[model samples]
Target: MVLLKARVPRAVALLGCFVLISSLLTLTTMAQTTVTSGGIGVHILFQTNKWVTPNIHYKAGTGSWTTSPGVAMSASNNSEYPANDGWFQFDSSTATSLEFVFNDGVGVVWDNNNNANYKVSATGTYSVVSKVSDFKTGDLVRPSDGTGYHILFQPITWAKPYIHFNAGSGWTTVPGNAMSPSTYAGKFSAANGWYEYAISSISTVEITFNDGNGVWDSNLNANYVRTSPGTYAFVNQNTATPTTAPSIQGYVNGPGYSVTSASETAGVLTINLAVNTASISTSYGTDLSALVVTVTKTETDSVRVKIVDKNNKRWEVPKSVFTTGTLGTDSSSTSDAVDALYSFNYTQNPFTFQVVRKSDGYTLFDSSGISLVMKDQYLQVSTTLGSDLSVYGIGESTRDNFKMASGDKQTLWARDQGSATPIVNTYGSHPFYLGINSAGQAHGVLLLNSNGMDVTMDSGHLVYQAIGGVLDFNIVVGPTPAKVVSQYTKLIGRPKLMPYWSYGFHQCRWGYGSVDALRTVVSKYKSNNLPLDVIWSDIDYMKSYHDFTLDPTNFPQAKMAIFMDEIHASGQKFVPIIDPGIPDDNNDYAYTKGLSMDIFIKDTSGKPYLGQVWPGPTVFPDFFHPNAKTYWAEQIQLMYKNYSFDGLWIDMNELANFCPGTTCYDNPPFAINNVNSHDAIYNKGISTRRIG
Candidate 1:
């Protein structure tokens, strides 16, 4: 797959010379802050050796603190302070005093003045001293033996510090090894007064700190987790009690549901569930008191299970979106459960369900252990996994492994992010995963919901935590991996076969400056005895990167037609990239036509949602709009009339935008593990709350 940010051309067996073009416009912006008169303006200076951005966690008087690790501070250009210092200016017109702390922005290390925050009453510059001595002026302190994973600890008070650790598998003997007094002048070492220990030849280590007499700091018994080979600070020092990490506020497990009534008809089971209100509310949203579950035997190998609020109406994926296979009938008259290729069993109170293979009695999915959480904005469910599990295909992420690791968290929220970034949501969301057991028996599960979610695989379980939508799951059972895939595709419609020539060597790049450059690239490939089947053009062919418009100077209509004739004669094809953002210009035919048809996504104020893209100000076509198909077809045909391209490269369909507007769905109460868990839902994408 070609990512928009960085397109890496695939190496094909047939050698080809592709044209490269330079983009004419580059977007760059500098942030400027303006301070109001009478507002408190305080500049903070901090020093550190680590190459990390400095940040400040600050609040005015008794106000709430800024989001951790707080707002980033800019590198100081002030001549009065040291050149290496980071600067942060606090300007709040209504504020009296400021209480703040400096950090490295990663939440790992901080300069908190020994846990007491810094305070200031007036506008001035204050220097934060985190280290005992400046490393720049003093002799640089290095580890006794540099090659290892190091941990620097500052105990509450200990005569001798020892470390009990494990690198990959086994643990060290008894009280473990003694630690040395640190002379390191790094960010972690400088801020945290040092008692250091090194574990040689290991990339990661799980450790617990202890004194020689057996008083231990095992991170409150949870132990410090594995981290990469680098000098780190042991921030937690609870020698008496086990360490407990902070939990998300107002987030808790549900009391689950109980089946108040159940019935079956024509191989379909419908159950009415009553909410168990015995547990505390999750507080993200009010829990529905009642829910309904429908289980359908869609086919011999497929089962569909859907859960939703019984009384109130809610949004669901439209039935017209995809073609689900026909629901099969069970002629057995004995029980609600039909004996098919798979069996569905359930418990009544604190509901749990299981899908098991009938032949081997192998459980494919079992939710017996975990509680089900369903709310207006949050939903969570989990299934137990077998010991010999090898799961694949919850994408579209760029992962290094085909089989997912045990401790992996995959977020499903489509965004216009590059595939080069691993373990983050990108371009498309596929809530399907295939799992195989030791006996090679495979099964597939598809959570047919479009809500943002984080799917975690850890400790013999697969958990789903969604911020919206129902728990609609489709399971396909197969005794073999290949058969499981076939069964899965049958249920969710098979992919369309591409044109035969598409499999051949295709040359493409962003910077084909003109028609002449494209022709030169094709000629060079032929001269070098390399096979070339298709030529592609990026946004360079468009007029100022506006959709459906050609650059009259570089790719004139007359010249393009002549070039098309030459390429057609050689059985070669041409494809041009088409971005979804329509230029909001009044003179643009496509934009005007779409506007008349009312096919553009609108902002909260009922005006067309204008976003920034290559075309400057743009509006996205609402594909969900009734007349969108007609308007889009007309625009594509108009472009085809100008350039006889063979295929269309739909780029940036993630509906990417350079600037997320004020009315966009920037924040939600429940957060998904979105790209690095730090980015907002509207980051580089349209608002999720918008609809046709």
Candidate 2:
């Protein structure tokens, strides 16, 4: 039987070339250390190491140097490495004081601050236990004395709100934090509702507001940061205010901006927009300096219109996740107002445009009602919607029965928050949504920008407030929902096929304690004749809940190997969970190697951004790192050789961090604190959840 092959091609295979060379060079310096079947208990098993064939270089105190066991399999091609779960192991059996680090055949690549080595107490300890870490615990400090701070809360629909914050220890609640409602409400401003708090000596503070009831205003992962020192406020401009027939504020009310240049060629219309920037005050930039709108007939039923800054470059998704090429050749059409089964009407100034489906004359998108506000750092795009239109899938969050009702506001921000909550940013971000009109005609729209924003569907309009990035999106016209989905998958890759046995019965949980316990569960399944194809465990199997190490007392290496062998013998598979955060453990092999490879995501200060996770604070791997594939492959090989599991269970992606957005070691760029603002989103919100 042929085993599954990793689809990495030669072009991408070079991602690990440096790792391979470093591994080969390191071998001569260190002998092949071996792991005995004894029960000394491997204390820390580090995952997320980027090095190929990581060897734990250790010297406790001033004692003789030692290396951990070499990986049982080659790291170059870790097909059996169980998907993306890779780990490296280390043991400090005979150390009085532990101060060790990792090397990838190259020189020392120390953790964050100036080659700083992590020190641990190993007196009377067989092996030093380590959890996944982001910073050297001491990096984040809180003061004992208090300092005055202020926050603004213009709530959309909350009553009697209170502020909860961390006062050096855990969460502390204070009542009546919401200030008076704002008086001035318009395109640029909202009423001020302020709250003040005294945060003592803490370097970082996380906060969330609640409405005496169960309802809370925790954007994304529940806690936002208060980074700047002294008194400051975060405004929520789009607060739900009492309005009698209140129209959407950002649309063109009167003769707004004027079109200076207009032309059409090959079924494409180009228009230059001139607007007075002085009118908008709350925007990031002083003015809407240059704007060019382009409408292209990319498909027979589909059309794409892009409004962008003429000279300045905007941020888009780094990877080619969006469909770059036109799905089909542009259809030829002659009518200036209509062409290729579609027609669009627009105003030269206060630029308003509407695209209509030629067949039934149905309006797919219309911006004639509201003014389009395009700021340097902020942009708002809105379109009139049919009353019966139903929308689905502006993702990374949960909704009721996979459908979005009218009057619903959805925030698009990829975060580490858990999935159980309704209306919170969860694990992945996909800025694509399918809208179905009253006649059951389905179409899809994809906003190809990665900036943070809030999308609202009012009674008859869809408003998009992107805080950063260009307003680039595609409209897929499908009379049927299935065709719309087909067009979407063609643009952004399709899902992979799962193995047949994966569909079978599986038993899994977090707290499986020992090998005997796991064995007993397997035995019970057999006794009941239950058709179980796979058995799974969470972080509990690791020593101190670290990624790679199994519990010495509960899950001895010898016993675990035997258990896995027996399970595989019966044609049953075993799977274990792996997370993205690598704890900062100098003594652990994974952290050391990762530091050397420089694969971690950096912060605004150009240092590794540390966020709290299941393993405590941890450094996240930059999946966009050039050597990410090789680093991942090598780690998986290390894990597969150590624990012969059938597959891996990757969790805690969404790069979940317990660190709130405002207090993150590296705050995300262009982050907006106003929760109710049209462009409000928890940018770079680190997600955190307990492993179950």
Candidate 3:
């Protein structure tokens, strides 16, 4: 019953020393930290303390590998780690987080090939690298083992489409396992043993294996890079028989550079032999001389592209370096760029080409570490668009000249500002703040990492895509909203259905003291039944709102059990609001118990935050902080262990800053306001809705 083994270093294990350390390309402008913003903001500094463990990555589309607790499992294709190879991904392009995390990341998961699932706890810019990990205990394996692989990317479908393994004959694949349109799980496509599944592309090929022992082996070929958006299938050329795992070695080159530009127009110029990809989202030196550099912005995948120059230099090209499209045409991605590019007069720089993992930004370069460049020499392209450009891409935003346009310029910005605050039509945080397309279809984006955070859509681009990040969200795409929601729930652990009354309307304010004052509202709704429901309770129903206890002075009979029974007996439901903030009286049972269990959120001083809430200065449990959430959820069972809660009402969720809307980013669990927050998602000229 051994499960997984060891960790796989992103470079060494997964890629297997494809290039010598010295050959590792040097960056002319290497980012100290990688940050991306949309509905949410993500920042990762690989050179920092996080370097202790190499980046984790795998080649599957959106898959997983797990075992019993304590079993060691990792992702990689190299032989370095005992067990390597387990990483899954699904973006809004297929099945990712478009509504959460600024709608800017993808979802990832592992399978028992069953129901076990987990989600991204943190939602931001993070990195993962796949490597050949060592054997520890569980099922995690290495690519070299020849077990087979699956990589799926289906933007139009979302039922568990995958490229899987078939044991009987040759390295037969199993498609539709990871991307099915049906609700069933663990189903296989027999007609074509689709080993390497892809609704869009296949980037890397890696695998896991069991040798009838406690050990497992893994290996991968970094050469698998996709050139288009479609499914692909790769058979293990070495399956039926065992053979020595192949070793691939390549070279790493440039980091920065100097170029010669031929300036011809206001914001466009052609640079020769200079390479830049990272700059597509930023600004750098001009290869072209003075021309009227009013604004400078470039576009592409909205991330820096690592280009391997003919001289073999590896430099990061800023996203703002190249001019992109407008309400018109985009020749850059089009094969006929030489045609429609007339608006800006752009041309491919003979010297540099942008390179990235076609599957996703998971890896910098393909196995060959080479991709051609198509710099939008502004003078040659569109007139309405120039270097000081306005463009957008997945998990993208601006900072340090790496913005939508020059001087923080935005090509589009609009919000629902009214002459009068529309008098709360519905005043409650709608967990259903998701955006849908023209078809009234909402999609699901399941975030993969446990390191949680919020994500948002750009100010105007309510429906954007997240190319890559640590926040792997399950991408549930669909033509229908309900279908989207159904698939999404499975990705993040579904929610329990509530009683019918929970769906009806109820009036609740903070000041309905004395059950009679509350009973009056209930009686009115009951007599009318005008599509009305349950009685509302705020604070007076509690014994100082301590939770799990009733106020003796208020209504002793209205304890947890009685309240629930009363509501249920009426064919109704009772929903009590609970804030993340926990009371701090050392004498209070809940507080003292939480403190003793060491499950409360700590301050910079490393103690619980005694903040003022309805509870009157309490310790707000850190739901984003893993341990706190586990203990917090368990505490629910602790209270409900005796009496169950019908439906949970999470309040003060945005940390409940009384101020509302936006707040400060100060101490622990502080609020942050930026384009990455969903507060920025606004429809420019489109309508959105939920499908699932």
Candidate 4:
């Protein structure tokens, strides 16, 4: 029996566990139990292509696992591999109160995790479904065909597949001369409907799989590595299960939020509302004593709506990044003072509204189809859109084109998925979208909340589901797309001005080994008369990839400074990547200063959060912290005094960490739970990247 313990105040400590355990025991006795005396059914699932038509067997807790008359797993849907689920049911009459596990017929790889065994009660018809996990990415542990390396790519009908690898020799594509499918005759083949490649060799290697048109899969910090020369197969597979917006197909508005009072003054409309349903709990940080809706006519063509708690304490984007000041009213107390370009009509019961263009009476926005919900941790708002809408500008997604297709669901979660991987949330997050109507006029909507969310563009409707923050939006309407962008930029800050040379050609690469190699690159560019105005460097120039330190042996400070002088003499510049990772070395000046100044983001327990990046184990500066700028500037000055770098290329500000953030906190914010916000360590070899 497990003893339930509780930590409580001294006065209640003695009675806490007793009261809770007694209540639980009483509840268990009242629960119903089924009885099945004849037989129980057992079901199991495994990757079809992983095991070559191997028979499957099971073992009860009372006896050794048996395979005498094992059943064969069918190869149906083998194309799905890891997600390919096949099941078999068997009659079990002998074992009651049975605990069992599945095994491959050969007795090698068994599905067994502590306490994960399935149990059977000798009650009525009973069945269990279990999935056998696939082998790790470069592992030889399994019932296998003895191939050294197993490589497979999610099959795409459009392009031919190939690999670019560093196998002792410098990086090179497999069928080096030409990529004609027939040229790589012996190398390419298909396994269970997936494009696969297998090789048996030993070396300190790195690889990435690519299709013909520069599409590739390479996790920035990790790649497939095999040391011992032996046969292995890449058992892992990629599935293009794009995330869809959370379904609200049959949902109905909970209750009609009534408008208790309203007033219009100086082109601003303010409404005081009372939630008609007490069951609707929208308050997060405080009690929902009241609700307020504020609408302002910001421009002749655009209006803004903001909903929030009556206390006026809702969270919003910091003023540092959002610099657009509010527009003051010209007159007082009259609807006629508002913009004449658009008109708004709203219903008081359940609170719905429609905005129409005054010239042609075209409906710019309608919210009657779906209900608006704003909660402490959740917010939902939907608007009807025109059928021929052309949408763009949800920043930082790798797409062949800028326009978002109809029915495309984009998630606003910043991630570290390196550039070139399409259909996944990459670096930055901008919860703003521009839509052009059939009449060639465009309008932009900006959801000002910074929380993660899924914004779906359903056929003629746009839905937003955010995890937290107030439901605030600034709308812009323009007759042209360019004008719409200009208005949107006014709400958010305008882009930073760039230097003249920055507009010229800039060349960058990851592995420019040493000072000599960099010089050679410049020499080649000059000899060929290529217009290279600036030469950039990746992490290789840093000592052990630690930021703010040059590799003494490869890029000696004296020699590097001399090289930079030579480049400057020719009217050129040198730039280096400055990652936001500070090594946790006690003697390291940058880290020590950050720690002393309390500048690093803290874990749940309030200690500085540690993550693994280029510098093995490092801490990240909390740019949100008040002292961050000072600390960052001090660190940059140290490097500037020594290297005299012309410019710094800021990267990895997405707070990319090899160590998963979910595991960093002892108690994480519940808002991050449902959102696809964290990643797992690459050593685990599970595709833990969250595409949603």
Candidate 5:
């Protein structure tokens, strides 16, 4: 059992247990103490072509077994083993006794010594053979075969198999040299559909195979390492099982809707659409027959086009969550195509609209080629772009470049993955992009829906495929890039002005373990002549990594207050990290108060959802709840009373979760490219269907 202490600011103090364990042991006799030392080594001999690099899965006395496929054994040439026979070696410095098995390292084939396993009670080298009659120890000389390595490849479907290798020298050219079909005797034959490659000048080689293209069969990405010159086979074990591709087809290609009626009120143009029933349905989801399209000129430089079901039964983002500018009322006539800075024109049958700039007559958004698709759980809209157009944003991804490539498909789903993962959704999702045409005119498009989506930019087209919600696009037309950003931020509220001290040099790390350590760090900056304006702390100060609670022993309340005073006297501010997870302890004040206030998110069973974080099991606060702000403010106020911290480092509010398969809602029929279909919907963060 691990006890974690927590305290509310005023008078309440509580003791919590993050985890508990109870074990009962029955012994018949007293245990004996034995001393053990030295190392153990094993030599395995098998047919060379049977396995690539054999793995040794073992457990030393009372220790745990290695993971499946275990550790790879290196090819050995100790002069004591018979030449041409495949030999591999495994060594451990401190394991005196070992119970072990051998595998092909690909997890498919194994040699567990006839299912009994091989055991050793003492240290030193042990030669393992297939049978007792095959055991021998002598200097064996090699037969005068060729002095090179022979590689045999069996491509599952590759039309042109190539070998890329290094022969104790350097690498061959990329994709290397192509191999020809061959019938090598005693090894793989043309009758077995194999391709052969041999390097005669080198006795040892490191090799990988690929098509002339970038696709590779690099031995499951580890490549093949060979030490002896002999016939070997390259078998790809990571080939995907053949199955039907995921259900994302027919989504982009669908029968478009036709405009039945159009009317303009003030600057808002409302168009009623009817589904075209001439073509067959995509069968992805139930297509809403009747839809409403509203085009609101929100600003002189911006316009908001919204598409939704006619009944408005589907979910839409509430105005309280994200506030936008007021709608403009400049247009007076229904036939006025040009409003202020832009014009809206459309084709009525297979309805497609274009937002054209009035100044330069540039088409900012033109959806002419493809039809607009609107389903219950899936919505798609696309616009063509010039070939020389440069696009940026659609971020919350670790992109390789600032400008998006033509083949880039940006998935707009807020995820909890690290920024090091390239081309995947991370943290915040801003479904907005800036496009600069070849002539340098710029415009911005903002998809204001809070749903999972795939924004694909390819083949001179920018497409939006969302799993839910209406297509609430806010287009900002700009004659210049700077004005486009200015108009864009104006619509979505400008960034707040940061404090002046925030611009100054500051220090932050995760390992300032105690209040004294923090003081020492501040002192060191002064001693080293480094100007420090602010200092920050990670979760180390929190009691067992719980939010709003300082560790009593390490970061004592009295000491932390004194340290804060000292830092303030030196004209420095302090900030500490705060995560959203409150330890799910009945005794904990934050958790109890949040529960009473109904602020925590609930599971499918209507109970408070439980997830694992730094503090074992935890409950997340639903920021959408009415009383959530009050509950959160009270906790922060109590914490501030105990320690006078200046600012907070809000973290983990991406609603990150350590628990798996805990979704409270059914997955959408359409899947966005978010690391895979299942993970994108159910395993990323909080479920998209969860109500705040």
Candidate 6:
């Protein structure tokens, strides 16, 4: 009976053991590991032009990845490479970077250099800066003779602004937008301001500044002129010979002849031609602004014009209209000119041309429409402010109203001005710019200051500045709008790429100090058979985050390379954060360097702007200054040279305004005091901008 009882107990114990084991197994099966078994992510194809599937599988966190309709993605030297397959964006004015993902599953990074290895983070917009077409010249130079017309060559276009030039002694200092060659800054010297261009778009020009006993004065009448190989429409008669060296002739205005201005600038050419003259016909800046009015003869009857723009690919209008009366006599001889009532056709949008005339107010015929159009539009010194908006049909005056729509037009404002109150018309107006076309391409303008401004497509905008306002902006024109914004298209933009290891995985927390603790984590990765890469050293790594100098206690014998080497061998990297804040302590290396160089971002008090960041209350670097850029670049160079790390992960470099977006702290060391300092380094590659 006792033996039978022992057998029954033994059987019950064995059954209990089986139940516990089964429960444990169930738990393990229910949980996920490095790899999970579940739904696959969105299926996609790479540049290889081959089919790839998660089914080809790699281990991931707690989940297994599998693709439906799985196929092996492959690439070789076989298939033709696709155009702009994949790209990375890294745009900053000074530096713009981009990387391409080829069809071969190969990733190539480019910024300061050509194709290098790179990675992408979350998928988004992308741009390719590689082999991007760039025109020879940039920005327009406004002339003081009268500040309306803007001329350029690349995609030859013309514009008229409230901009005007003034009569002066040396360079025509217009107090506003452009700089006269006489006052032009730098070593452009012989190749300085407003010289008649010798070639298309880009021509070696000269601009000189006269300090005390200057070479050339601002009196356009007295200054030397450079005659180009091109000829005036009427005088040349299509049979004129191309002259190697040409000279501009001065003529006298006669009765009924008026003035456009003393000087007009198109690109670098600045002309100060008077009312009318009887001499060989001559053209000024590439724009019609310099085609000074000279009355060969004036008549009671007026001539009508069917104007057009013949600058770009072809003329945008027709001929016929330009008429003239009989020729008049000059001091030396007689000539033909146009009459007073110069009526122009309203159908054509923008108009520019040269008029030939007879002396003493007699009428002269208008040249063919072929030479009428120019690059950019110019402001005409109208007898009256004719039609509020001349070229474009936008606002004519403060009272003129024009509607704006998201799809059709893009109105951009410069320097958000109104701040709730301050003046009677406290409605400090916003400076707005329009798209180049129905699609907003060809040109883009960002007026960088708070002023009453206007921007138009066919017509143009005007602005008012304070402190005698300096017309400053970042302007770009292209064949298409997409090309202009390939870098940072605020409307729709590309994205940055993640580091390869970053794609695999990243594990982090507040602080990570002590090599042993680091080693233990490394060992865990090895034992678990999981993939891990970065071991971030947060604030703890720095002695109060002063940056550059490391904490000996936290990273002893850092030179041994053992710590970094161990991770590297496993094909991983270490990243440390470097915020733009330098401690207030006088001894801080960064702070001291800034003070020594006069390069700290200053407040309204003309002292450095102070703020609090990760480390402590710190001073921001006045990166807008040239010296500051050099200093900042040096720091980056040191990181690569001294630290021997692969690359950097820049943070807090956006000049981000913390509490108030109204104030992003301005330091006027840039050329036009534009937000981007002349020295600021922009990522040149597409990927850099996106990642940033």
Compare the candidates by TM-score and give the number of the best one. Answer: 5
The local distance difference test score of each candidate is 0.70, 0.56, 0.31, 0.58, 0.69, 0.30
Q: Please tell me which model should have the higher lDDT, number 2 or number 3.
A: 2
lDDT of 6 by residue, 366-455 (tens): 222211212122111111111221222222111212442211121222221111111101112233233334432333333223322223
- Model 5 lDDT vs. the true structure? 0.69
In the order shown, the candidates' Cα RMSDs to the true structure are 17.4, 17.9, 29.4, 23.7, 15.5, 31.5
Per-residue C-alpha lDDT of model 2 across residues 139-181, encoded as one tens digit per residue = 2111122454444454444423466777457676454244443
Q: Give TM-scores for every candidate, taking all chains together and pairing residue i with residue i.
A: 0.65, 0.59, 0.34, 0.61, 0.66, 0.31
**Number of clashes recorded per candidate:** 5, 29, 162, 14, 0, 102
- Which wins on lDDT, candidate 3 or candidate 4? 4
Mind giving the per-residue lDDT tens digits that candidate 5 earns over 2-110? 1111111111111121211101111111111111233444333333345545678889877999999789876654322322235566677777777887775756566
Error of 4 at 466 (Å): 1.1
Q: What is the lDDT of residue 503 in candidate 2?
A: 60
Arranged by TM-score with the best first, the candidates are 5, 1, 4, 2, 3, 6
Which portions of model 5 show Cα errors greater than 4 Å? Answer: 1-224, 228-251, 323-339, 662-666, 676-678, 688-692
The residue-by-residue lDDT of candidate 1 on 493-519, one tens digit each, is 665677778777777765567898788
Better of 2 and 6 by lDDT: 2
Native-vs-model 2 lDDT? 0.56
> Model 4 lDDT vs. the true structure?
0.58
Residue 408, model 2: lDDT of 58
What is the lDDT ranking, best to worst?
1, 5, 4, 2, 3, 6
Candidate 6 Cα deviation (angstroms), residue 197: 66
lDDT per residue as tens, model 3, 31-56: 21122334343222122111112222
